[model samples]
Target: MSALDFIPELGHRVRESVPRLGAATRFLVLGLGRPFHRHFSIQQWLRQVYGFGVLSLALMVVAAFFTGMVLGFQGYYALVRFGATSALGTLVALSLLRELGPVLTALLFAGRAGSALTAEIATMKATEQLSAMEMMAVDPLAWVVAPRLWAAVFTVPILCVIFDLVGIFGGYLIAVPVLGVDSGTFWSQMQSNVSFRGDILNGLFKALCFGLVVAWIAAWQGYSAQPTAEGVGNATTRSVVAASLAVLGLDFILTALLFS
Candidate 1:
């Protein structure tokens, strides 16, 4: 295409994107605010918590354990070269708590929970269940969106904490018993370097932001989906992809802000 033709096309695309972004933003604001409305039900949020947190518990714990074990093995080998294997505890703990724990958990949450959310909502839309709710004088956004969003926003940080704890245990098991490092030194180094506020709180904050991003993106994609089988599948895929990228991108920004 000619340069002039490309310029107008780009401008048209940008203009189209404005409304879509505005809709998503409005959706987020409304969904968040809906819980404060008088008719809000705590049970709905609880059910979503079970769906987003309890159902994903095993997956999160298992992944965290293996990730920590892998970090332990690699950290030992790398640190052994410099005769600094004693510091393995600090390395593994900081890496997991500050970076791996929250980031990996977020990615997994995006792939698993986020995709499920999108598919469920999109399916409801495709089957006209959302429209049916409207016909019944229900606000679908309040019933369908708020609870899921808040549950996700709340649960992921808890999952992140679980991931950190399980991962640290896994690393300790490998570092102290399997790798033949002194148990005392491992605990000492980690305890000395890792502070609760700097490491744990910061990581939890990151997880919170990531959860919001994941749930919001998933819900928006599903709500905006084309209400067909193919569209639902596409929305699910897009939710995961978009949420994952947003988590990574946000992680970098958070890291720079919190640590640097």
Candidate 2:
């Protein structure tokens, strides 16, 4: 546990990760590029959309609702201290539409669907299915990887929008009747403050970026997984951890760029 003891381990990790990151970058380039060379399959993309988006809808709704309700309680109390309870809707709406909605949706999606994507691909690799596709003159990158990548890139923003709407409603339910704030004041303040070009669009853009990060990381982790059951589990875990960290890091950079 000595401070000096950590340096060699950290350096070892950095050395190992440099090559892996390079390999992943190559995989990403092929994943993004190969689809353009092949005939597109809308059906394949739709199937993946269902898996990544529709299947995860209930989780999104429940998480978003509770998150909004929590925000309502916190925002109301924090604002009321300054006699600014009337800004509750503004607080909740701006928070959701700008930051919470996209970021939380991405984290949840990375945990749920990104892990699933990595697990599925890793299992297929473990079972030699990707190799079998190659033997049949089919490119696995095009047939397997592209659809899921595009589907995730498309669905996450839609999910974020849904999260925002549901979260706002949950906050309203708490702020209005439950907390006795006027409904009109709540919504009107939100409407007056929230803007299409600023709040909503920025969130959707963040969602889009997160989708790409989740899909790319998950796909690369699975594609590069060791062909073993234990490797599949490890790859899935890595996908979630990597995607979540990437989303958070990107959020800070993007927020600064968009707002500053």
The residue pairs found clashing in candidate 1 are none
- Residues 1-260, candidate 1: write the lDDT tens digits: 58579889999999999999999999999999999765467999999999899999999999999999999999999999999999999999999999999998899998988999999999999999999988988888889999999999999999999999999999999999999999999999999999999999999999999999999999999999999999999999999999999999999999999988
Error of 2 at 105 (Å): 0.5
- Cand. 2 TM to true fold: 0.94
Report lDDT (Cα) of residue 258, candidate 2: 89
Q: Which residue runs does candidate 1 get wrong by more than 4 Å?
A: 1-6
Cα lDDT of candidate 1 equals: 0.94
Candidate No. with top lDDT = 1
Across 43-160, the per-residue lDDT of candidate 2 in tens digits comes to 8889999999999999999999999999999999999889898999999999998899999999999999999999999999999999998898888888888889889989999999
TM of each candidate vs. truth: 0.97, 0.94
The C-alpha lDDT values of all candidates are 0.94, 0.92
lDDT of 2: 0.92
